[model samples]
Target: MSVSIDKTNSVVLSADHITKTIGAKNIVDNLSFDIHQGEIVGLLGPNGAGKTTTIRMIVGLIQMSKGDVKVCGHSVRHQFVKAIRHIGGIIENPEFYPYMSGFDNLKQYQRMSEGVTESRIHEVIKLVGLQDAIHKKVRAYSLGMRQRLGIAQALLHEPSILILDEPTNGLDPAGIREMRDYLKLIAREEGIAILVSSHLLSEMELMCSRVIVIQEGKLVTERSIGSEVQTDQVTISFRVNKTQPALEAVHQLNDVRVIGTDTNRSEIILQLKEEIIPQIIKILGDADVSIYRIEESKQSLEEEFLKWTGGNRIA
Candidate 1:
């Protein structure tokens, strides 16, 4: 499945039939996708599915055996410098000088990068919520703080795209939440496109606007997440005083499947259209089944990911 792109936003990153081969094997085979500005797109796959290889190719760490990548219309094959200049990324753990202050570390990166002003450094530090610890040594920072500092350094150059691999790795629940919030803020406030590769499906569902799934080095599907997700049917649970009567009433409806039942709570779960819900409520009421609650539940990203990948564990 292909994701519906927003025509209003500019495409910042485009992978055009990119492929990577080694010896007789194709590690990344004809993968293609486009990430738009201000959108956070998740790249997902199982083990040896070329997620890393694809990311490496995009960042110019590894050359693609076929096709090309474009960043802001600059081709990676013919205009490496220009294409790469629009991107800032962290492959894995972001390293820093342990003894150096976070501010000084960003300054160190600023000296190596072109057109990075001191004000930009301060701006990113505040953007990542590290203003208070900006002057503290890196050694004194937690993993989450260091991650924020690394992001601040990457943003100093004002790149249009940000790429991160396993950005939430080694972070606690709170730290992961913090990272997700900061990334979303950057995407929304700065209008930066973000491509993130992570094994954390739950976090990705919360953080990304869309997801690109691949298996065996090929594209499996790409779909929207979060608020953009739409489906013809939804899973709903009806908690009533009489489960059997409620189930019987629901069976009268067309295109509705009774997926589960919980006699303990007198709940019956059914898969049906949202429009059919009012009819169900009325039918149950007519049947004299006291309706206590009606709740709609959507499938989690992990469930969808497993279905797409045929039960393969995400790497």
Candidate 2:
């Protein structure tokens, strides 16, 4: 959310340098970013990183008090209908007639959509891997199935740009994996640009080609998936024979922060990088601290979210 919209997505869907005020507070301030074509860009921040506001602006769901936005060369302010026609989104949980069959619900949507057709409806159902369950009533569908249906509807019209927020929140592991693979496939095959927002770091790391991090309604960091962020800290978890000698060896290392200790598992999270890990292991081994195993722990998306949001309480 804080990441300035760069020419990231390979195609620019929406662009802005705008501000929004609700009563006495300015929720979004001078925010600017780009979502390029056919790229999966991530918007991650604390719970309220102006993510929803930005999404709203792109979709013309909310009018920006200032600045300009264009989608596929149509102005969001002047050519709202035309610009929005180029986009598709599922901001929160999509609403549906609870008693309707999934196929019927999609039919209702298809009937109302300006150009989407029955075959397109079938295409999306298959793409979402919901063929077996689509005929089932919405009431019988699991939460994950419902979420997939939401995505199905978003994809129904074949818009050039897609947006999904917290897409994996309630999904089981299998559902999450399926959705990730499907999104990647469509992005490549259809050349559609995508912007996905989530609190789950690993999921974003897996699903996104690039990520834009936000915190406290402000921009924090925007980076590609493998882009290195300076940790200012590194952690190594290992199983060793003795605890005391391990502790002593780590303490001897300069500026190491010994966060925890135990008989079998001692966690030494120091302010360093992966480069120093070998030296630490060698020091402990020479001192007879028989190493069981050592590894660099990967931070979850939530942890990265917290760190980038300055660990601030979400307002």
Candidate 3:
């Protein structure tokens, strides 16, 4: 469920040079990024890198030592009531009364929040695909179901930005996929800007359109994911009937290097641009090398994360 971001969309959440300090230590130092409408942005950092601190500041859970956060053009500092009205978040795990039904839990939230109609409650339940289980007591709900219920509670307010911390903390593969799918649904169908913090790199790679990486309380990099990510060179594997001739033919081309080969010596892996692939095929064909298959290997998000963080393991 990859969603394309329209750059023209207005910024929904902005953290402008926000910093958090405790005594002499700066937990989050001057971090800044903007999440646009209909975008799912991932917040990534190694342990103690201020990801949670940054999130806390944005949601107004804690005051920023310096700078400001604006949600839907309302400053969180100057307008706490107005700024917080446009935010819905689950800091860690979503809690519920075990005895209460899922629908009842949402009804309670609706009563606490302002201007949330009963229709909106039903809409969010269906949006998260929990219509069938909405009436079931939350004590009987699975972890995935509980997570969806939490999201529904958060969305009852129709917040412009949804902030989640470790949304998939403990779940099997299927549950993880379910959470990812529903989050994407919220962003695409509801057009809400979502900011998520998670340590699961592989899942983040699949779920997020863009990732904001931090290290030592500083900005490391911000990268686009999936089809939106651009790379000038890719590792291409060419399986041909005659590997030696294919290798020699590709060697004649400039800006191409042989990175690896198969154990059978029937495959040659070269690093070069995709546009020059046809040229390599033509050169191989002229040398009577029959092409069997071709594969282009783009760098995975995990690899890029490691590179950007200088091999620091993500927390």
Best-performing candidate as measured by lDDT: 1
Q: What are the lDDT figures for the candidates, one per model?
A: 0.85, 0.72, 0.84
Best by TM-score: 1
List, residue by residue over 1-315, the lDDT tens digit for candidate 1.
Answer: 122334469999999999999999999988888889999999999999999999999999999999899999999989999998999999978999999999989989988998998789879988999989989999999999988888887788899999999889999999999999999999999999999999999999999988888887887766666755446778787889987777778778766766445443466767678888889888999999998888875678898678667889898
* TM-score-best of 1 and 3: 1
lDDT of 3 by residue, 186-213 (tens): 9999999999999999999899987888
Instruction: State, as a TM-score between 0 and 1, how close model 2 is to the true structure.
Output: 0.71
By TM-score, how accurate is candidate 3?
0.78
The C-alpha TM-scores of every prediction are: 0.79, 0.71, 0.78
Cα-based lDDT at residue 13, candidate 3 = 88
- For model 1, state the Cα shift of residue 23 in Å: 1.1
C-alpha lDDT (0 to 100) for residue 146 of candidate 2: 87
Listed per candidate, the RMSD to the true structure in angstroms reads 10.4, 11.6, 10.7
Ranking by TM-score: 1, 3, 2
